[model samples]
Target: MQRRSFASAVSAAAAAPFLMGAAPSGGDTPASAAADKRLKRDMVASLEAELQDRDTARAVAAWIYDIGFDWTPATAPIGAFDFLIAYAFGNRPPANGGDPTKVLAEPGPMNELLADTVAQVRAKRTLPVYAQWEIAHFLTEKYNMSQVIAINPVIAADGTITYLSTDGVAAQIAEKRKSTPGGVGTAGVVGWRDHIKRCVLTTEGRGMKAFAPEGFTMPDTYDPESGQPWTRRRDLYLVHDMNAQWQMKRTELVARMYPNG
Candidate 1:
C-alpha cells in the first residue's frame, strides 16, 4: 500500500490543492532577499539557538534530511553548519581556537539539536516533493560521503524515496521513531484495530477515502499532473508499507495494524 511522506503530516493543507503553475495574480507581495552577512548571522544564531534544545535540534536535522532527499548532495547541509560553527567561535580570541566537530560534539549541542530538528520538521510539515531545491544547494570543492547525521528514507506513494540527515551546525538530530499509534502520521497504521481508522484509493485510481477521521473522509485530493479528481470506491486492503505507492498494495491487508498477517 502507498501513503504520504513529508516534512510534516499535521494540520490539513491549503483549502485548494496547491494551485501548481501560478496564482490568479492576486497574491501577497514577496519579500526582498536578505543580505549575505545578515543571512549568515540569522542562520548562525538560529542554529545556535535551535541546537540548545533537543527537540529543536532534531527538527533542524530533519530539515537537512528532507533537503538532501529533495536535492541530494548538490544541496549540502554542512555549509550552513560550518557557518554557524565559525560564528560561535569567531568572537573568541585566537587562543580559544574553534574546531567545528569539537564544538558540535560537546554536551550542549549533540543529541539536543538532533531531536529538536525532528519537531521542527513535523511542525512545518508540507508536501515533501514540493520543497525548494535552489535555496538549499551549496557548491563545494570536496564531496564528503557523510554529513553529521544520515537519516532513513521517506518513501512517497509513487515509489519515490527520500533520505534525510544533519549538517552539523548547531543542528543534531537523534534517530526518530514512530513509537505509537498517535505517532503514525500518514503511515499505513491508523487508530486502533477494533475501531480502526484507515485510508484507501479506488482500484480505478481516481478516488479515495479516510475512514472515521474528521476532515479526512473524502478529502480534497487531486492529481498533480492531469489535475483530475478521484472518485470514491469501496475500501481496499492496505497491507505492506503504503509509502511505496498510493494504489500499490503488495500484501493482503489485515485487520491488525502490525505483523502484516
Candidate 2:
C-alpha cells in the first residue's frame, strides 16, 4: 500500500515548527505556517488515507467477537509529545523513579483521548483497554475502569524511570498473552488517526495481528494558555506525521529482519 507521505503534503521542513519564528504553541492563535491552504488540504487527504485500509474495518468486527470470546483488550499507547511537554515544563517527577500515579496529575489532551477510548469501550460491550504509563494511571485512577491491562514503567538501577515506547508496550502485551491461557492474539489499537497506523504496525511486529479504527483523531480545540491546538501546532503536526512515517517504515524493516517474532 503506497500511503501518502506527510513530507510531500507539507512543504515545511519537519523541524520548521520548533524554530524561533514558529507559531505559538497551544491555544487559538493560528500559526502563520499552519495557515497554508495547500498544507491543510494535503494533510487532511493523507490522514484520511490512514483509514482507507480494509484492515481497520476488519479489526472493528474482530473486536466484537474477541470481546465476547476472550475479552481481547485494545491498546491505548500515549503520544510522546503529551509526556514530553509535561515533563519539560516543570511537572516535577515523583521521588526516585518516576511514578505513574504522580505523573500527569492534571487533565490534558491525553486524558481527553483516554476518556474517548473509555467511552468506546463502554459502548462496545465493556472490553478491557490496555494502556501504559500515565495513560494507564488515568485509566485505573480517574475513570475507575478495572478492566485494564496496565503496563508499569521500568525502573532502572539508578532509579531512573523509563516508560515503554509503543513497540515496548506491544511487546509487553505480547508477552502477557503468551503466559495467559487462550489469550486472544488479535488486538484493537486506539489512537489518533495520524499515529494509529504506526501503533498497529508495532503491535503486529510483536507477533500479534492488530487493527486501528478510524476517526479517533487529535482534538481541534486550543489551549487557553498557549492558544495552540493539540495537534495543530504546525510544527507539532508535521513532526508527528514525519515521525509516524519513519516509525512505520522502521517497523516494516524490523518485521522483515525478525519474521519469527
Candidate 3:
C-alpha cells in the first residue's frame, strides 16, 4: 500500500548491478568505465544485427520464456521481462548464460506490454502495494512460477486476505529497502539480511520452507549483509526490480555486447 520514493528507487537500481556482477566495481577508473560501456554497446549492436531476421525473434522468444522463470535477473539484465522475450527468441544462445548477445534484438510486444503497464502505473499514480500485486499476478499467470505469488500477500476489496510466503515477506522487505533512502545500509536492510542468514542460511528457516522454490536447497554459509555465497535462496532474495544498480549493469552489458546500431 505504501509508495516507494524516487531516490530509493535510484539507489536500488545503482546497487543492484554491482551486486549482480553486471558492472565493474565503483573502484574502476574512468577509462575502464568507458571501455566497459563501449563493450556493452557493441554487444547490443551484435544482437541487433542477428535480430534483423523476424524468424530469429520467434525462436529467441520461445527459449527465453521457457528458462526465464528460473533465471536470476541479478546475473544479467536479460530478465527485464520484455528484453528477455526479444533476445532469446531473436538471437542464438551465448556460450555463457550471461551473454548479452542473446538480448540485443529490438523491443517486442512484451516490451510494449511492460511499458504500457508502467505507464498505467504512473498515469494512475499506482502505489507500491499495487505494483507488488501486479508483480505477483504477472509471475503466477505468465511463468507458472507459483513461488512468486506465494511470497506476496494480497488484501481483497472485501477485507479478505491471501497470505504471502516467508520468502515473499523477505522480498517485500527488500523492496522496501530499495524504495527507502540509504536502505541498503539502513536498519531495514540489516534486518532483512539477518532474516535471510537465519532463515535460509541456518536450519531454522529451512524446515519452514516459507520462501524457497519447492525442493530448493540452501547453502551452508552466506554473507547475507554483503550478498555472497550465490545460493539459490540468495538469488531469490536478490530478484527484485527495485535494484536499479543491477539493472544498469545488465543494460551496460547488453550495450557492450551489441554496440554500433
Candidate 4:
C-alpha cells in the first residue's frame, strides 16, 4: 500500500486541540540558531571521537537513550522525531517538520506516526525495522501518517539490536501504549508528568550524575527515595498540581512548533 506523508498527519493532529477548544494561541520560542549550530558542532565532534571506539560508540548511544527517554516530558505529544531531527540536522528547520525537498515532507502524517511511535517505544523499549516500515506504509496507505523512514540504523556489537531509528523506536512505543491499561491519552499524560518530575526537572536542577555513575555525588538537599532536592521537590509538586492548567495553555504553543497528524 502507498505510504502517507508526514505533513498531512501533523496538519490534522494540529487541528484536534484547536477543534476541541483546548489549544491556546501562540507559538513556542524556537531554539536559537546560534545555539543550535554550536550544539551541532559539539555533538558531531563528540560522536566522531566516540565512533572510533566501538564500545564507546555503543555506550554513547546508550547514554543518549537514557537521557532522551529519561528527560523527555510526558506533556501532550512530545514530538520525539522532531526533536531528533532538530538535534541531528542542526541549524536547518524542516520545510514542514522534516525536509520537504529531500523527503518526509508530509507533516500531518509523519507526526501522527511519530506520536504513536513515541507512545509505543516509551512502553517496550524495542522494535524492528520492518515493523516500522510497515507502520510508515500503513500510515501513508491506511491512516495518512507520514512517508519518512529515511534514517539508517545504529547497530549493536552483536548485531542483535538496533539502537537508533526514529520510526522504529516510535513503532515500539506506540505498540506498548496501545496495550497499556489507561490507553494512550492517560498514559501519555501520566508518563509526561512522571518524566517531567523525575527527569527534566531533576536534571535541570541538579544534573545527570544524580542517577548514573556510581561515584556521582548526591545533592545535599536530595532525598534518596524521593529522587529530588527537597526544596525543588516541593516546588515541583506545586507546579505539577497546576500542570493541567498550564498544559491547556502550553499545548497550542507546542503544536505550533510541532503541528500534528
TM-score of 3: 0.22
TM of each candidate vs. truth: 0.16, 0.50, 0.22, 0.22
Q: Tens digit of lDDT per residue, candidate 2, span 133-241? A: 4565666666777666666668767666565566777777777778755654556566544445556666777887676433234333323432123344545654654
Highest lDDT among the candidates is held by which one? 2
In candidate 1, what are the lDDT values of residues 156-218, reduced to their tens digit?
676453322111211221112123233322211111111122111211121111122121111
Q: Give the TM-score of candidate 2.
A: 0.50
Q: After superposition, which runs of candidate 2 have C-alpha atoms over 4 Å from their true positions?
A: 1-107, 214-234, 247-261
The Cα RMSD of model 1 versus the native structure comes to 24.5
**2 or 3: which has the higher TM-score?**
2
- State the weakest 10-residue window (summed lDDT) of model 1: 82-91
Error of 2 at 52 (Å): 32
Q: Please write out the lDDT profile of model 4 over residues 1-261, one tens digit for every residue.
A: 123345435444543332233222122223443343344345435765866643333334333333332232423233221111100110112344542333332222322333354334433322222123323443345544332333333444654423233224334444444554544322211112222234322222221111211111112221223312221344454344344334533554466656872
